[model samples]
Target: HSRGSRALNDGRDVVLMDADDFFISENLCSHISMHRDASEDGSKVKSTFFVKFYQKLHAEGWNLTLISRKPEKLRNATIEHLMAEGCGSWSSLIMRLDNQTQMDSQQLFLRQRTVLQKRGFKIIATISSQMEAIPVPC
Candidate 1:
């Protein structure tokens, strides 16, 4: 995120793409297509940006309903259990896992991240940086 700060606040005409948008715009589908069969065994699932993303959402009051194409991968139950353990509203969101991405080559074709607002919701961005196969809920 720090990489674009200089041009961002310079007062010149500037626009920013979230990690996801930059990936699609660059035609680097393979970069984003590498996590389709990620497992929770610690091999496929490596790390998750959900914490960071969640922090962003928490501050913005943006509720999330993740849409993962792999229904079996939904950890909503664990999230609900964690909520029962007192993780708060963030836990309920775990109960709402609602969508999934299509798969190919055991890797995800694409993972879409969107932002929700009172009036509507929109794809805020996409990311192709699969530096490590992060396990979900990491």
Candidate 2:
């Protein structure tokens, strides 16, 4: 429904992210984790949460035009085939779950995201909290 009410706080635009998966922090773009082995806990983490969120959008008549640094042009059928063949990377396997512009670089991703914003997609930029968090003594 509401992309969690947004506000023009400080200089950058921010929005409250969907609960259960996303983690919004000072940085606007940061989800990639060093612990590659960590599980999403079935969408408990940020990236998986965003992917699931977008999947819902796809079902709701939203035409997604993703602009990724790593651009792959293939149909869902191909992805399925790859999975069936058991030959796919973690990134490829994950990206196959939806139709999105999967990129590698933040700059490129942001550039494309800006263009999409101009084109009108109603997208929000959210990052995980701990990524850029200033640890306060507990």
Candidate 3:
């Protein structure tokens, strides 16, 4: 199946997500809204959409990995929200600390991910993006 493709599956594929993009966004127009200042309707709509999306994916055998800056807190909240939305069987979700090194090594760390997969879950270190000292927009 293609990356981010909507192809149906027997349930078991994994979906990789960037926390800032997939789970939360700053602007109401954005697909994901996790920003504290986001409007209630926007946030609720996005969150419900994702909850249902994940439920369908999970039911179809798809796993999800959430890369986030908030660590355990974010993961717990996400699970709680999903459960509250009637999605209670989600398991094997991979949540980790969002750091520049991990982001930079996203592709490069595939080999490590292979190894880490054996452990079920792991939290990697994180740091701010340097990007040649250019300030990244918040």
Local distance difference test, each candidate: 0.31, 0.35, 0.45
Candidate 1's TM-score reads 0.31
TM for every model, in the order presented, reads 0.31, 0.31, 0.43
Q: RMSD of model 3, in Å? A: 9.5
Select the stronger candidate by lDDT from 1 and 2. 2
Model 1, span 3-113: residue lDDT tens: 222222222221111222112122222334545443422422222343344345434443334322223443544344324423234312311223333343113322322
* Displacement of the residue 48 alpha carbon in candidate 2, Å: 3.8
- What shift in Å separates residue 100 of candidate 1 from its native position after superposition? 8.3
Candidate 1 residues lying further than 4 Å off, grouped into runs, are 2-49, 72-75, 81-120, 127-138
Highest lDDT model number: 3
Predicted structure 1: lDDT: 0.31
Deviation in Å, model 3, residue 24 alpha carbon: 8.1
Q: Flag regions of model 2 displaced more than 4 Å.
A: 1-44, 71-104, 114-138
Report the lDDT tens digits of candidate 3 across residue range 24-70.
Answer: 34432343434455465565566666666656665555455544433
In candidate 2, which residue pairs clash?
21-46, 23-127, 23-128, 24-127, 66-101, 68-102, 68-103, 69-103, 70-103
Please list the Cα RMSD from the true structure of every candidate, rounded to 1 decimal place: 12.8, 12.5, 9.5
